[model samples]
Target: MIEPSDGAPPDSGMTLVEVLVAMGLFGVLASILLGLGLSTQAVTEDTRDRTGVNEEARIAMERIAREVRQSAGLDSVTLPGTPAGHTSTSFTFWTDFNNDGARTNTASDPEVMTYEWDPDTEELSMTAVTGLATVTRPVLAATVTSFVVEPRSSRWQYDQVGGACSCADGITTWRELDNSAVGNYNSEPDPQELRFADLLFVSMTVEDGNGTQTYSTQIDLRNRS
Candidate 1:
């Protein structure tokens, strides 16, 4: 047994081993907290990127679809030039601006709307041609990788009254108007046939810092009877 002398001071401070152990525990806790904070920040950033990309795609697709649905027909002549066997990265259509059931070609009646994608600038733009002299252009979306519009037509034969023939005797299949070629529709000999598109397939791809996202939707023409 060890007895302290009357004059010796009592031990009041921690030993070196105790201090070292405390410091090691503190270091471990600090490392764990830092890792958690980093992980949370990374997750938040990823979520923000995804949300931004999705919103961009949604807005563009919705705008196109809304206009297509309200349109009375397509305008093939307004599209830009493209090589043979390739689809034009642009689309143009006519809508009854006055909301009349029938299409009117006047400046204030039926409006021509054109959507063009610029590959060099990665921008999707829209142009509105109301009359021979009035034109307005706006950028619809940015950071666009690709924009494609495919028009499909019904193969069913129609009678003189504009009603489809008997299904059993007439063709009932729906066929691609441009034969799966982008610019073929615009180059068709009869411009009148381009007046209506039974179904419009809108597809767009957008890229951001996070990655690329594609959005697609089908729009049925209201006045395509």
Candidate 2:
């Protein structure tokens, strides 16, 4: 028997339900791909943030160390200790941090380089003083979280009073020594003069919030100067 070809075409396509199901499948696949892309982006950003923080810390530490190592004159050096009979943390001295041969006050002329923190931005910055006077200009990276500077001196009692003893280039060990009878560098102070005794310890921490990533570096200032 010859089957009559139906004028109506045979069911040439999927049913409504089948079509809907296929669309749903495509949607699911697209969503999965999108999610993967987003994940990759997040990971990349995190890595970049971490790397940037670490690099910033290293640069800051190195710069500080270099300046300290080049510190000019005995009086130019100051430690984070009490001066003579004064027991105050506000005690600071002058140093030619830029190797300009003249001592400049922290706030005055013959300016050098200094690292200062910004309270509003929670950042640490380096500024170079221009001209013969104390003019300042920015240099290097910013966005630092915590910057702490600790200076160790020759005399434990008067670390600020007597200048860093045994101040020499290439000396690596530092010790805390006792004060002299007449307030001078004794032949053998308790803390042997090395990098650390006269050294300024600069510690900095930088971070990015999203990943809670942090970078930190500890540098001895005496070695760099």
Candidate 3:
């Protein structure tokens, strides 16, 4: 006769310890995947922030250059330099704002523009004055950390513009952003003239949560005599 049958059939399922180990391993894998996903998302956000800051800075610089170039007379300009005579956070000028070959800035129609930087608020703004009405608008708020305007006289050699100049359009290359008037188009002494300078060395730095970018341009003022 065969031996007596075992009390229970052979065990087919895992033991308690094995089940617990498997559960722990699965938990570890899930945690690792979650961590990697979060890391990737953070990197993407940072890159976007940096790109936005750079683009914003570039736009601000171009705006200033465009307006200054159209100006016919500079009332006053403040740049950063020795003796404290050339250093200031604001510049004022009267744009040529000609109405299609017509004259502008008469006794009752004079228009003045000013660009001012506030260090405490980290803001840059533009102010326009027409006769007695004055309006101030924000240009680049909370992005521009520094705005320095350096005034230079005409006629520097091409080879010396880069090395001797404190700024350039981009990457410190010496380039005339725009051609000037054919000749001394306005030879008369303009009441708005300041130091009779024609070139503006603009340097600005912008920063955000991501990073900072600095841009510089040599803007050739219009209506130079």
Error of 3 at 198 (Å): 1.0
Model 2 per-residue lDDT tens digits across residues 112-173:
45556554566555444445445434333545555554445534444333346545433222
Best by TM-score: 3
Q: What TM-score do all the candidates reach, one by one?
A: 0.65, 0.57, 0.67
Better of 1 and 2 by lDDT: 1
Model 3 regions lying over 4 Å from their true place: 1-11, 79-88, 100-111, 155-193
CA lDDT, every prediction?
0.63, 0.48, 0.64
Clashing pairs in 2: 65-224, 68-225, 69-224, 69-225, 70-225, 175-191, 176-191, 177-190, 177-191
Off by over 4 Å in 1: 1-12, 15-21, 77-81, 84-88, 100-110, 130-142, 156-193
Give the least accurate 10-residue stretch of model 1, judged by summed lDDT. 158-167
lDDT of 3 by residue, 27-85 (tens): 99999999999999998887788777777777878887887888775676543432144
